[model samples]
Target: MNSDYRKPLPGASMQGEPVDFFDARQAVEDISPGAYAKLPYTSRVLAEQLVRRCEPKLLRDALTQLIERRRDLDFPWYPARVVCHDILGQTALVDLAGLRDAIAERGGDPARVNPVVPTQLIVDHSLAVEHNGDDANAFEKNREVEERRNDDRFHFINWTKLAFKNVDVIPPGNGIMHQINLEKMSPVVQCRRLDSGAKVAFPDTCVGTDSHTPMVDALGVISIGVGGLEAESVMLGRASMMRLPDIVGVELSGRLAPGVTGTDMVLAITEFLRRERVVGAYLEFFGEGADALGIGDRATISNMTPEYGASAAMFYIDDQTIEYLKLTGRDDEQVALVETYARHTGLWADDLDTAEYERVLRFDLSSVTRTLAGPSNPHAHLPTSELARRGIAVDYPRAQQDEQAGR
Candidate 1:
């Protein structure tokens, strides 16, 4: 461990003072302290902000409002840009089209309503690799299949692209949205020139229609994946309201075993965390174990935020973060700015002690074995040896004959 690395950060609180900013200690009183141990990663991040930003009266008000009145509260959410892959993007648009018709029937202009925030829709995720590995024509064949199946959806998307404001379309044949986000999008620290001619900086936060939006969390952006209905509400400038959540600090120890891809590690972690029931909490991955993983590996874990049912899987600012920013073509100045801001703001991994989570979970990398999850859910782990017991390995020659004879 670096001696100078793990110091308390300055100006770490939203109110600029340390006053038990989400009252993790107090909130745990109403519920069993042990219950806090099970919150998902997403809920934890939200809890952190509610503690830091919500006014005291509003804090109690906000907490009770939803549970008591069930009313939605408007809070500030500034997503850098809305990201969508083709499938969900198309479905979301279909809903919007329905909404337009509903508005027209109510004597409102259908064309007048639009996304209030900057939105980017990418045509990825519809491509399935029916063809095998890296053949010269594989990309072409895949594109053909994609275009054929998605023609109706594409036609609507084309209309949407021209009809809507604040929307940009990245056409098909591009890579996955998260990969593109890492490669080209996501300015680690966003800067906008204010009307007074001074530059202002705030944390980058976003909500994507897809559940994997947390992939960008590896870059220190506060992002969450929401359902289309929830996203539509957010798009219309509504605040997502809620009570404070339990933020769980996951202390990872030891490096991953060799030949283990980030995917494998994340799969293992996903199963373990799900069994632990950390749904809706914010999970911060830190320690020597976290420091050792490459940014790509961190992203793999973060990308599965939905699989583990956590809100955000965050890896704090560190040397690996800086390296990823550079590798992804971020400007040198912006990269330096990220380090400066994080170090100053206590957002850095080292600055996080007395960082105070409602709960904590620990994991050891060495104990994870080669495994696979699912006959259904990603969290359902079915060891290979159990296949026979699960009936997955049964002889099917007679079953095939019965099906052919319609018996």
Candidate 2:
């Protein structure tokens, strides 16, 4: 960690005192006056991590890329954690064991090999649903089938949990991995103690083994999906190399119509973003419409990020985020820490009023109607009203005739 940017974090600590934090906003401003205020939310968070973790020699250049919005040079990003499902998680652990064997053969201590980053492996994907949902005991029956079928796999997975350091295993039937990460796994902000006996707080960032990992982005955490190999590398303590991405600003305006569900709005937004060609871009959503959305509603949009071809769909840390943290059973002290850190570090939603974006897309929430996407592709957006015109819907008489004729 660079000492130059380190400063005291202003917040009531768990012991009722201030915590230490890296002052990224001040560091950015010192280099380029007034530039930090103009950075989008994503940039600000990236800058903070750069300040906290980048080598002192490379710090300036890395931050300059963010300040100038340049993607010319690759910078290092150290994710706070890694999330995985049983399939890839098992493969990664097997690779680690192989590496340990190789190390022992080379006269090195195999015991020293362990993941530097914390990893959580959830067995949510391997379960088979043997019983129908209508059955009252379907969940239990399905779990039993999963246990029987995946006995060997489960044994290996359970062994990994005990054999590996920094690995936490959530056994099968816990919940969907993404939803678990959103509501329980991610802390929104993380605080740690250094070797020198000082504490520092930073925003939570992670890379998951699944595409829908960006669901935590709704909580203002910078989470993204990675391939199995990349996830393995990160687990082994390698920084994920990245150049600054095309950060696009999406300004949501107006409120949703009464009775409109978040599903409809997300489907509409997904189609709109895909049409605008947001492939591989990091999108920051803000404005009156975004402020009005609850964390659940924001998560609805963020969960479809890959379908819309965006890398991350991020929101700012705001009151809704705070409320959601509370509703999800987070401790009051931790919730206060999140809000305090964000506000002090210029990551709060209100602090970003002056943030500027290179490309701004305006979307009206009220314009969204009941919608559906994809008979085949998720991007195939069709409002309910257009279904008949598009020949996807038939009149009652035609439907009856087709049903009778079995056509």
Candidate 3:
């Protein structure tokens, strides 16, 4: 905290103490002159997190490795929080309780075992798709079935709310976790008070128990979906170790063809990227095409990151993200904070136009047409007009005739 970059924030917390932060922009400039500006937004964010969170002695080595793109060295990533849907989220909670019980049996302190970091458990997966559509009593009926079937899981979840120190649960019948995160939970930039009595501001990042957790990444938050085990590990204060992922720039140009929804664009892009074998890379969307896309459109692509085998699909912090924050009813002060932080930290969209990548993929949005993904695989984009050619249409009369003749 003795560096030139460590600056105090302009507020007093509930404890009335001045908050401070390690200025990531300054750290990048000090460690490697002019390099921060060259990093893609994702790299810039990762650098900032490492600067603020890593030990000072080890900081130089990690910073150097990141700037030089040394994939061999792994660094620590401490997420701001964890998000979980009931399916895997419940499993993780049950595992934690089991861990506590095992510790107690061994005479270790059971109460000491709690999720150190904030954990949000949304009961989004409880309803069966069995009762979907048009029925006025559908939700009521599904709730009954969900409660009856998942009574034991629900009991554990309720206990976790009271038993764990930093656990919050959203009862069933709420929307999906990813949707909730996009609309409300993720702040893009988080300002919080530390136990050390200093409040700090940093980019909002998280790991979810489902693969589509990266949906919030469309808003320039770094969220990844992880397994329940990994979520538990992070929950217990373990740093998630990761090699710097390959940051691939995807340059988009041309407006979407008329009638081509964001879904069509994503399906086309998914198919293209999948064939290009973009596994393990962070896909950064940019160019005029990217700027033209709405946050809703961007979220569509980010949500499909896992299907294409990418680690994260990210959109740079731009006016679009700020507009989205406003439209979602975020407080004016928070929106101001997001813009100020992003602009100053070299994470904004305009700051990235000159950023270079080791590899680049070009896609023209005009090439996309209105299309639907598969009846099964999401990447299988079959145009409605081509369905007959693909033999997806059944000869209903022929089938009925065959059935009547007992053939």
RMSD of each: 10.1, 3.2, 4.9
Q: Model 1 reaches what TM-score against the true structure?
A: 0.70
For candidate 2, the per-residue lDDT at 148 reads 92
Name the candidate, 1 or 3, with the larger TM-score value: 3
Give the Cα-based TM-score of candidate 2 against the true structure. Answer: 0.93
Candidate 2 residue spans exceeding 4 A from truth: 15-18, 104-108, 387-407
Top lDDT model = 2
Model 2 agreement with the true structure over 51-118: per-residue lDDT tens digits: 98898889899999999998899999999999999899889988998998999999999878888899
Q: What TM-score, over all chains together, does every model reach?
A: 0.70, 0.93, 0.89
Clashes of 3: 0
Higher-ranked by lDDT: 2 or 3: 2
Q: Give candidate 1 misplaced runs (Cα > 4 Å).
A: 1-80, 91-113, 128-135, 195-197, 372-407
The parts of candidate 3 lying over 4 Å away from their true place are 1-4, 9-19, 102-109, 132-134, 384-407
